[model samples]
Target: MSKTITLLGSTGSIGTQSLDVIRAQGYRVHGLAANSRVEMLAQQVQEFQPDWVAVVDEAAADKMESLLAGMPSPPRLLRGPEGLIELARHPVDAVLNAVVGIAGLGATLAAIESHNDVALANKESLVTGGHLVTEAVRRNGVHLLPVDSEHSAIFQCLQDAHSAKTLTKILLTASGGPFFGMKREQLAGKTRADALKHPNWNMGAKITIDSASLMNKGLELIEAVWLFGLPPEKIQIVVQRQSIIHSMVQFSDNSVLAQLGVPDMRIPIQYALTWPERVPGPAPELDFTTLKQLTFDVADEETFRCLAACKKAIAKGGLAPCAANGANEEAVRLFLEDKIGFLDIGRLVEAVVDSESFGGTYTLPDVYECDRMARSFVLAHI
Candidate 1:
């Protein structure tokens, strides 16, 4: 029996790889959505023949509509964020949210409210609105599966219900990005191409830049908190250059279990889609025979100010993390466009985190307002 799935961010790095898994498994795609990338979205609609498609950008929606003019039975087209929300509520077997940034938060909540299981690739969804998402999941009795490599590794290790009770800490691993051992001075003049050259993974430009700054890891730390009910301090970031050991968990008796795999997004993506029931699919088995020694190093929060800022934000609770994330997103966007220097990314994010006492119980409106304020702060400061 094939499962019906709705895929958001259908033209991104993770989104494209997710399609590979969906195709291999013969699952039905009920709906597909993307912010732009009209040509790619058109190609996907042609291949998958989905029941509905959404283009968040109206101009791109027109392009998508023009591209799909003569299909045998083209899917219904939905436009803008409401289109994304409506497409997410299609009640599929699973909603794979690969949408990037804070934009994915509403769609994630919509999917859960519609009583659909979510395989979350969008870390910002939890980073910005973890409380609301978890509440919706608990209220509706749905599973909120993690799809990020590090969180997925932690999730896989925690599957043993007996030993899981004794879990003490999450040894979250990091690839250390392209600028691992460099000091702040060395990164001051790096370009977008320099940042996008991830040592182990091929990702979208935004995430590639985030990986360069270690902000991606910072966001993951926050996401891990919401997903595993662990504090930010309980999660330790280890720089594993090989990108092999996805992550590890420690038990009370000083025992540790780690999940190891090749650096492939599809592995975690496929796992999220068919969780609790492992199936042989697109990703290949890791070959340890040719594998070299795995190395580990301590993360320097002093050097990666973004990581340090995230610790403070999550500790203060409430809208702080949302603000931190918003600031980083804007800072990264500016850095990518060469409007700001590389080191300025960290400087801007930390300043925004320190600008206010962002502590309070927040509603959805509060989250968006904090996000807006953070972005404005970054814009004003930069």
Candidate 2:
């Protein structure tokens, strides 16, 4: 039987790689959605011949329709967030949400509520709306698979565990981006070009920036707490310069299991799409002959303040993570636009997390409101 999937952010790094997985595994593409990259999305639609397509950018949707106008058969096109949500609600075996930011939260909830298992690569789905998403998973009885490499490794390591109580800690690994051991002063003068050069992974601009600031790992920490139902303290971020050891989990019995592999996004993407069953993947196998030493170091929380900020956010609970995420997004956008320094990313996030106060039980709307408040604060201050 062929599995049908709706791929959100079909033009992104994970999205494009997911298309490769779909092509390799012979899965059917039921629907596709993207933000402003209509050209790439149109190309995917042409090749995959999905039943439906959505472009979140209205202008891009208009252009996409024009681009596909003369085709013998074009997928039905929808526009805006409503279109993305509608695409999520479309009946499919799974929804691969590779969307980059908090914008992914809605489609995640929508897919789960509609009884579709979600292959989630969007960290914001859990970072900002962890409680909401977990509740929906329980209520709808759907699988929320992790697509990020670190979380997927931890998920894979825990598959045979008898119970959650048997796991003592999750050792989340980070490649430390392009500036692993750099001090704050060194990063202060770094350019966007310098920050975007990730040492291990090829990723989107926003995520690359987050990785440079170590905020990506911080966000992942919060995400792990939600995805595994573990407390913040139970997760330890280890700086693994090699990127080979994706992540590790320590058992209560003192044995640690680590998932090792090449630094490839498609591996985890494929795993998330085809859970409980491992299939042949396009990523290369780890060769012991050519492999060198795998070193681990303590994450420099003092230099990369965003890591500490995220730990604080998790402790504060409520809208703190949401605020931190929103502020970081805005700060990264500014940094990319040449408006802020590299170090200012953490400064702005810390400021927003400290000043904002949207704590307590939250609804979907409340999450959005907190996101708006944090963005507004960052934009005004910047």
Candidate 3:
């Protein structure tokens, strides 16, 4: 069936892949939102011709206005963070939230409050505000679909209610990034360029750096805890050298089901959009005949302190994951700008987490306050 959707972060890696899915599925776009990529955003608006468009950056919004002046029937334009929030509240069949960071948390909540089923690519939404988002999902009776490959794999395996009832634990697989085997001493001199060279996936700079530091996997771990109602210990991180075997679920009877495919984001994006109803997608099938091997190794959390800190934070519960996420986002930003060393990324995140007592029930305002506190701590200490 044809569906209407709103795409947040329309110019991002996940956003663009989502557009590809929309194009293939003939899904109609209700709205499109982005931060500052006006040129790309303009092209998207022209193609999709959404009823509403939002630009988070002021200058970019001005540029977008001028660009839209020539359109015979340009969609309504909403500007700044408020505009993004408003765009999320506009009811659509599905809201594909691909917004990159913690900024996505608010929009995710807005969409849910509006009773829109959210196809969430923004892991930070759950990482920083899992309780709030999950509660909203439960209250609003909207589906919270996972767009991350590992989570999608786990989601797919849990499709059968009969088997899902006996589910015991999840084996979350990781590509191990570029510096998988490197020790702390070996990582000291790694540069931003070195960290960005992910061996398995093509992702944005911030995420790429997070992957190298194993912080991406850490954030995903926190996200899974919320999505699946599983403890951190139950979701074991296995280093699957090959990008295939995205993730697996182990049942109480010792049976296991795994989702394997080529490392294309489109497969999960498409599934999230057209869930419980499979359709032919642009992504290719896995060539198992030519496959060499699918090997596993234990994640060296001692060497990758970010992953360790995340496990600790989730176990601590409440707003601890929020602080951890805020710190990692800030640290990754500094690392990208060459203001901090690669190892320092983990050091800063772990330190910020250690310095705070992040507990208690949180409101939307509380989430923002904790995020600011964590970011401020990063700046003060750095």
Candidate 4:
């Protein structure tokens, strides 16, 4: 049976690779959405023939409509964030949210609220609104499958394991980005181009910058807490330069299970879509004969303040994580635009996290408010 899915962020790195998986596995793409990439979205619509499509940028939606006008059987077109939520509510077995940052949070909640399982790639969804998302997952009885490589590896390792009680620690692995092993002085003069060069994975500009600053790993740390119901203390990040060992989990009996594979997003993307029933896709198989070495080291939190800041926010609870995410998002944006230096990203995020008050039970509106407030603070400071 072909599983129907609604894919958000259909033009991104994960989204395009997911389309490749869909084509290979014969999954039905019922709807697709993108931020402002109408050209690519049009190509996707033509190829996949979805029931509906959404463009979050209103002007781009107009352009998309114009581009699709020639099609004899044009699918329904929706505009803006409401369109994304509407697309999420559409009847489907699952919703794959690959949208970057907090913009994807609402669609994630909408999908779960509609009783649809979610394949989550957007870390901010959990980092900023974990309480709400986890509650919805429990209330709606839906699976919130992880699409990120590290989380997917951990998820796979935990299958049929000795339960959460037996799990002692999660060894989260980082590629260390392109700036691994560099000191604060070494990174001060780094350019945006230098930071964008990820040693392992091909990702978007925002994520690449986050990876450079180790903020992506930091955000993932907070995300892991909600996804696995673990405390920040139990999760330890290991700087794995090879990028082969995605992540590992240690049991109370001192047994450690790890997931190893080639650096490929399609592997996890396919896993999240097919789940519990693995099917081979286009990703290359690992050849042990040619493999050389896999190395690991502890991450230096002093050098990368983002990781420390993330720990602080996770410990404080409430809206601190949301504030960190918002500030980081803005900081990354500023860095990408050459408005701020590479080191300034972490400094700005830490400042915002420190300034925000913590410890409170929050609603969905509070989450968004915190996000807005953080961004406002970053903008004012910058």
Q: RMSDs, each prediction?
A: 0.8, 0.9, 0.8, 0.9
lDDT of 2 by residue, 1-382 (tens): 4799999999999999999999999999999999999888878988999999999998998898998897789889989999999999998999999999999999999999999999999999999999999999999999999999999999999898594569989999999999988898898899999999998899999999999899999999999999887799989999999899999999888899999999999999999988889989788898988887999999998999888889889899998999999999999999999999999889889888888555789999999989899989988887
Q: Write the residue-wise lDDT of candidate 1 on 182-271 in tens digits.
A: 988888789998999999998999999988889999999999999998788889999999999999999999899999999999999999
Candidate 1: which stretches are off by over 4 Å? none
Poorly placed runs, candidate 4 (over 4 Å): 161-165
The stretch of ten residues in a row with the least summed lDDT in candidate 3 is: 352-361
TM-score of 2: 0.98
lDDT of 3 by residue, 1-382 (tens): 9999999999998899999999999999999999999999989998999999999999999999998898899999999999999999998999999999999999999999999999999999998899999999999999999999999999999999898988899999999999999999999999999998988888888889988988989999999989998888889999998899999999998989999999999999999999999999899999989998989998998999999889888877788889999999999999889998999888888887788678778888888998999999899988
How much is the lDDT of residue 347 in candidate 1? 92
**What number of backbone clashes does candidate 3 have, counting pairs of residues 3 or more apart or in separate chains?**
0
- Prediction 1 TM-score vs. true: 0.99
**Model 4: per-residue Cα lDDT over 61-120, one tens digit each:** 999999889887889999999999999988798899999999999999999999999999
